[model samples]
Target: MNTNKTELNDQELSRYSRQILMPEIDYAGQLTLAQSHAVIFGLGGLGSPASLYLAAAGIGKLTLVDFDEVDDSNLQRQIVHREANIGQAKVASAKSNLAQLNRHIEIETIARHMDEKEVNELVRQADVVLDCTDNFASRFALNRACYAEKKPLISGAAIRWEGQLSTYDFRNEDSPCYQCLYPEDNGQELTCSQNGVLSPVVGMVGSMQAIEVVKALLKLPTLTGKLMIIDAYSMMIRTLNLKKDPGCKHCAR
Candidate 1:
């Protein structure tokens, strides 16, 4: 018998038996997930569901970063935070929710803004980075950090009834990064606060972010060179091929 074969303890086997039953995951892939680390850069709408599913899927370690407290406004789409959690650190509330779903994993929370150096270190340590953040400044900074660290980044955004998702794998030199898809200095950005979001739009996008994170960890085919755009009102989903910009300042060789 191969000693390196993925062996599940009685507890884990019972906990993840459904995942193990899937042909794509089975035992080996579940073990791969068990040893992987994911870093999420927000605990809001997108990060809420992303963190929850990632924890439930048994990622070995999850590092959650957010600098905000739960607001009554967040309760609309940020499902991880409850009315009782308002005024609490979003990361703490998220951790509490995630732990309830899966207590077998390690959850680390950072409830402050991270500078470039901090982001770089965290991205380097992570197998994948989920950019569920809302603002362009944070998104571009995270893009730079992930590119510098050569980590795959799962980027998601939702505002109103529209949402978008993409993955940038820095390991692939030809892949376009988040900056390539949009200008870093995008002006007058629309926010969920400024423009009302349908409650389920963010949840839909966030759930896909989790799916992309899992596939990235499992080495499965992902949206590495494509972008997905969703119009929830019309129920239309479209995937567009993304080309690396030769003049892209971020990922261009």
Candidate 2:
């Protein structure tokens, strides 16, 4: 993220004119967005829209991390990939598509999985982290890394017509970490492949994650310490208050 570049060029100004028109996100907010960097952990369903919107909205830099390859089955909900990219690594595929959307922004790709040290270093470089991974292991690893680095983490998940979104802003002393929300990870974890998910369910949740990321970069009010549950089958949404766990191994003092 180049904080040195304080001004938006003519083309950038015109490209982001619509979002810049809003009262809250005027010129300044857009510029702030242009200097921010976001790291997304997955390039699947949730990450597809999240990365697309962030790129189109002019996020200065995006680091994509995913070790999986694009399969034909992923085409149903992973909108950032195409049939031509079916055998390509997800991070590579996403970086290619996102670069096309916004040529000015920098898109970095890590096509392999990383250990704890690497994850922590990546989190330290990002202004915000987005957890779009599927399994509990990846989520737990990312949560620890973000909490350790004090970066805000925006996590989203969807399965079987249900989805959830939350932001854990570790910069705040009182903000809850992901471990506070899910203390115990049972061995059995549900997956979209097994239980199945509605296409739009992940889309809605992923889009919301993008909105929260923009809000986070602009220092605007965000979903910090709150969990949004979406039951797309019923067309209903609800929010729950998230409290920091005093005994949480990751965030507790």
Candidate 3:
């Protein structure tokens, strides 16, 4: 329950004036929000919105990790970067966008690829980690890091009008990890380029992912032990209660 409310001065107050007006996240919660740090993996379709929202919400430190470069194709869903940023490194572009949105918050960009060691370091440093990568390998990698470090994770994925989310490890001792939901190691999964996703789907899931991160940091009553599945086509959302899989290999490790 140790939180800070005086961290925001008159200038910071004026900047986060809108959010500070909210009862749930008033001056105190907004101060807590400003003192928190969230590290996001993947600067693609999902990561763009997640990072931007967290940064705008006064997250003290926002770290963006991705080695990919921006491309014309990414604009359809990656809202953090514009047409002019197409040729730049994705992490750099994302940082630029967030910095433009809020200068008071700090931005950290990792232009290098994330290996296991790097991920572990990030997990150790971050209050909440976000898994927004497009592939299972990266998701699993991040999951392992968060699990090992006992850090919370806000995971999200979207493909072809379908989006999914689940909160893991943030004091929910029995919540399922990402691998539990997807353990098959399927050879094929939908990708933005191949499966064709509506641009908003990514933002929708990404924003939700940001919400989960904020909740995790604030210990708010959000998706701590459930999966939120969203079907854009049907405009339907379902909550799937989850439990720890003792037989699961990753979290047990």
Candidate 4:
């Protein structure tokens, strides 16, 4: 991971003044964020908040991938899409919002689902990969791609007042990949469409996903080998340590 060592411009210095004041994220840290690239799959509830926060924080390049259009039903939680964006491509809507947030950064949009080859190539170029998709198939594909590229992936999911988040830094050989946590589909795929989710439930989890991405770029201690489970109804949160499955197919090699 190259820091680039480029000095922040006057406008940049003023824009990130607040973040630069922090001990953990001084001007150097902010510059690191400015030089990093992140790709996020799925522009729904989770990706919405994650993209917004990442753009506001000034990630140099943000690649957004999603093949869905903005549905009227999505406004309740997908904060990045407004009522005007109904029926519009999610990536286009996201690009408009992100462009408005940070004109200094680059925002790339792919308005289609990525195939395996596309996923691998894109993951190879990104410093961070965020799996915000809601389906197991996409999650598994992203995990495989990230593991191949040895990129850090920040994954999050929310449905029916329940949410989960984890970061897999495949660059670390001992770290567990996403497959380690869910080896196979157990017939337990519940989506917000079927079960319904609290409005803020996704926001809570998505914001944390953004935090993990930022922390990962700064090389700060992050949730790399742990899973965070959240219950919005009970307001309870728990973290579990993750171990690599020696026999796991994706990362055991």
Looking at model 2, the pairs that clash are none
Model 4 lDDT per residue over 133-242, tens place: 99889999999999888899999999988999999998788889988999856457888888999989999999999999999888898898899999999999999998
Please report, as a residue range, the 10-residue window in candidate 3 with the lowest summed lDDT: 1-10
Poorest stretch of ten by lDDT in candidate 4: 1-10
Candidate 4 TM-score over all chains jointly: 0.96
Q: Give the lDDT ranking, best first.
A: 2, 4, 1, 3
Query: Which scores higher on TM-score, 1 or 4?
Result: 4
* Cα lDDT tens digits for candidate 2, 1-253: 6688889999999999999999899999999899999999999999999999999999999999999999999999999999999999999889999988999899999988798999999999999999999999999999889888889899999999999999998888899988898875555789998999998899999999999999988888888889999999889999999999899877886
TM-score of each: 0.95, 0.97, 0.93, 0.96
Provide the overall lDDT of each model, using Cα atoms, as 2-decimal numbers.
Answer: 0.89, 0.92, 0.85, 0.90
Best by TM-score: 2
> In model 3, where do residues sit more than 4 Å from their true spots?
1-6, 184-187
Per-prediction CA RMSD (Å)? 2.6, 1.0, 2.1, 1.5
True-structure lDDT of candidate 4: 0.90
Q: The CA-based lDDT of model 3 is what? A: 0.85
Cα misplacement distance, residue 129 of candidate 2 (Å): 0.4
Regions of model 2 farther than 4 Å from truth? none
